[model samples]
Target: MNDVNVYTVTRLTRDIRLVLEDTFQAVWVEGEVSNFTVSSAGHTYFSLKDESSLLNCVMFRGNSGRVGFTVKDGMQVLCYGRVSVYDKRGQYQLYATKMEPRGKGALQLAFEQLKEKLYKEGLFDEANKKPLPFLPMHLGVITSATGAAVRDILKVARRRFTNIKISIYPVRVQGDEAKHEIARAIEELNEYNRHIAETGGEYPVDVIIVGRGGGSLEDLWPFNEEIVAREIYASEIPVVSAVGHEIDYTISDFVADLRAPTPSAAAELVIPLKHDLTVRINEYRDRLYLSIKTKTEMLEKAVKTSRDRYVLRAPMNVFLQMRQQVDDLLRTAVSGISHSLELKQRDLGTVTGKLQALSPLAVLERGYSITFKDGRIVRDAGLLEEGDILHSRLSLGRVTSRVEHVG
Candidate 1:
């Protein structure tokens, strides 16, 4: 053998570790944690193991605090970081950058992860959810237009409310295109809402049904997508999520305002049953008819009682009593007129006698004489001048004379 060179294992290991670290920037690993311990210097040390094998792991406080939940021993977790050697211990360990619980199936894991992100962003909050309209005149449906779900909803809605209008925006319900189409439909509906509100036009849709027919997890995977969930959450109109079977829940269902068990159930929920409504209307009509009949009967009875009253039924008796009262008043009025005439005659006789007593003729009969001048009675003797015309009057006649001498 040529000269054999002895080299320390540590030097070879160091070189190999540097090469691996440079080659692999970062990676993700999933396992249950063990021998988890934290130092006062804010460093964590743990062993990650599956049934087959185990690897040492380390997470610093800076990265650990970013995890929402507590990390404990035996807790299955997926950690993302790089593998590097600990120089002192001469062992390789994971330097964890992020960590989350593992062992949940792929769908469940994605659902949880998206849910946690949206919850942190306040997208899935109850306060953001809108109230469904009590009576929707027009329902906008975002699903495959030709699918069985559309037919079911239309059949149920039309059978329940014949006048209800349904506008279907057809879109792919699965595969890569489903999420984008669903999101676009939601945005279009919101835009329609704004347009109607601005133009003061009738709202084209009152509630929205965003769903598809039942299928397996992979078939209904679009509804579980984060984009579709966020779009449903951000919609202004109330969304009724009807995706997958009743037992299957997607992210859209969690964030929607209401979740329907199926497409038929969603239709039934959005409208009323015509037969039940007709029954209620008939009951109301019967009650109204009875109320009116009762009121009319009472009014007729009142009118009949008034017709049978003494004043209306005994007109002859009423007339006889009124005529007797009028005759009695006439007799009393005649007696009062005769008595007043007799008193007036006596007053006239007395007044005539008093008038005769105060007459000038009566004074003449007592021998009183009168003098006159110029066809007038002389009031003063001095008024009579010599050669003035004079007149005299007796009780029965008058005399005309000329004055010739003073008195």
Candidate 2:
């Protein structure tokens, strides 16, 4: 009993924490995530467990940011952390620094997660896409300047169209910092376009080629980044994503306005064949010339037919005929006017004869007189009254008198 030493609880807990951490420093654990939760302080707490065993894990705020994925319940994960005991709870737990989904590549999982996020935000919608110019005068290319992608694209573009202009925006296509470079290249090129528009310049880059040659998924990861996808979406110029061979695709492919199978294909699509354009233009010219010739021939034939008419062949004779028609119209109008005046004079004479025949003057001229009493004609002897005023009208004079008797 005397040989036993007494120990405090705090000291024992601290010693256990240190010993556990030292023993399993930088351990790798693979299990299914259970009861995953993030604390208010940005620490992720979860249980990593298989069928028979369970281990508690925590990722502090500093390490959580670097995990690069959301921790969820029922997710199979591989984690790397230091094993240590939590002194307060007197329990051993894993302090994880890194974690990834099990049975899948971490970068691929990242790509999928980002893709879902952007898709929900409508970044990949067709309505948001811009159409490529049918014949772009200038094309902006964003890739490694020294890469085979640039070489293939230039060769194809030059072969397809003789007068096409290409502006190369050199950028790294892979590695940790490649995504930022690609994004900046996109923005810078867009800015250049804006500058051109503001300046009222012609032949600015009408389309952009954003891609690289075929490679492993790791090599093409920059194109799959969220920044690159958004840059392509927000660009004013149409973008063509040609990241790799036909079998491979990236997030850029989904967001770009068009996706070509290869860089060379992108070049071919941007500019049509020079020979085809020439053939089309020649066809239009030939049609126009043929139509004009046919119309001219018809007009000439019509003029010839017109000259064969008698009036057109004898121009002076036609004028003489029109003069004769005018003289005939004048003679007819004068005769009509004279006949109308004669008829009016005859009517006036007839009316005058009738008025003279009905006139009372004629009767007075024949030695007849009219007697009036009280302004009324005395047509009967009974109409006369003694001492009434009377008037007599003769052919040349009027007589005033008083009625003295009746006869």
Residue 187 error, candidate 1, Å: 3.0
Model 1 regions lying over 4 Å from their true place: 1-102, 113-131, 303-407
Error of 2 at 105 (Å): 3.2
Give the lowest summed-lDDT range of ten residues in model 2.
63-72
- Residue-by-residue lDDT tens digits, candidate 2, 89-133: 888999999998999878888888988999999998999989888
Q: Candidate 2 clashing pairs?
A: none
lDDT of 1: 0.85
Candidate 1's TM-score reads 0.52
Candidate-wise lDDT, in order: 0.85, 0.91
Please report, as a residue range, the 10-residue window in candidate 1 with the lowest summed lDDT.
Answer: 103-112
Report how far off residue 345 is in candidate 1 (Å): 38
Q: Number of clashing residue pairs in every model?
A: 0, 0
lDDT of 1 by residue, 140-168 (tens): 99999888999999989878998878899
